[model samples]
Target: MLDKKRIDCFTCRHFYITWDRDFRKGCRAMGFKCNEMPSIVVYQNSGVECLRYEPKLPRKQK
Candidate 1:
């Protein structure tokens, strides 16, 4: 048996495609593409260096 899980769109930083309206607009405004999925992976207990640990942006308050 295998355990599988569906990826979450919100959790993914690169889930948005280039053709997506949001990504298109954002890219134009920022002059770059936004990451579409969660690129960082923190270890459960390992105290090792991680190259993919990108800090998440603060959530906007509305």
Candidate 2:
């Protein structure tokens, strides 16, 4: 059995929630906004995992 890695846009630093009512999510790295999560959209269009996935940094508490 092959192990599959989960690709979540929420985990990426480039991922961001949008204010647009039509497109709710976006990827800064990819330079496009979409209605669905960027990771899923990219995978569906490209048939591969996101190449620009960068782990989101932990928020600093003041």
Candidate 3:
């Protein structure tokens, strides 16, 4: 089940925050924004979990 290992958009590289209040959340890979997490939006629209999930790289501590 998708719920077993949830795809967290916050940890994904493609995840982003948009200026639009209605669609503040976004996915770069999918090129879309939404109120909820991008993964949830993808699942809602496509009836399948997001396939473009890539884990975000750790930022260097400068």
Instruction: Give the poorly placed runs of model 2, Cα more than 4 Å off.
Output: 1-3
What lDDT does candidate 1 reach at residue 43? 21
Count of clashes in candidate 3: 0
Answer with 2 or 3, whichever has the higher TM-score: 3
lDDT of 3 by residue, 28-53 (tens): 89998889888887877888989999
Models sorted by TM-score, best on top: 3, 2, 1
Per-residue C-alpha lDDT of model 1 across residues 1-62, encoded as one tens digit per residue:
11234233344332334665654322221234444432211122233332333334678999
lDDT values of the candidates?
Answer: 0.34, 0.87, 0.88
Report the alpha-carbon TM-score of model 1 versus the true structure: 0.24
Better candidate number, 1 or 2, judged by TM-score: 2
The residue-by-residue lDDT of candidate 2 on 1-62, one tens digit each, is: 11377688889999999999888899999999999778878888988878999999999999
Please tell me which predicted candidate would have the highest TM-score against the true structure. 3
**Model 1 alpha-carbon miss at residue 51, Å:** 0.4
Best candidate (score: lDDT): 3
Candidate 1 lDDT score relative to the true structure: 0.34
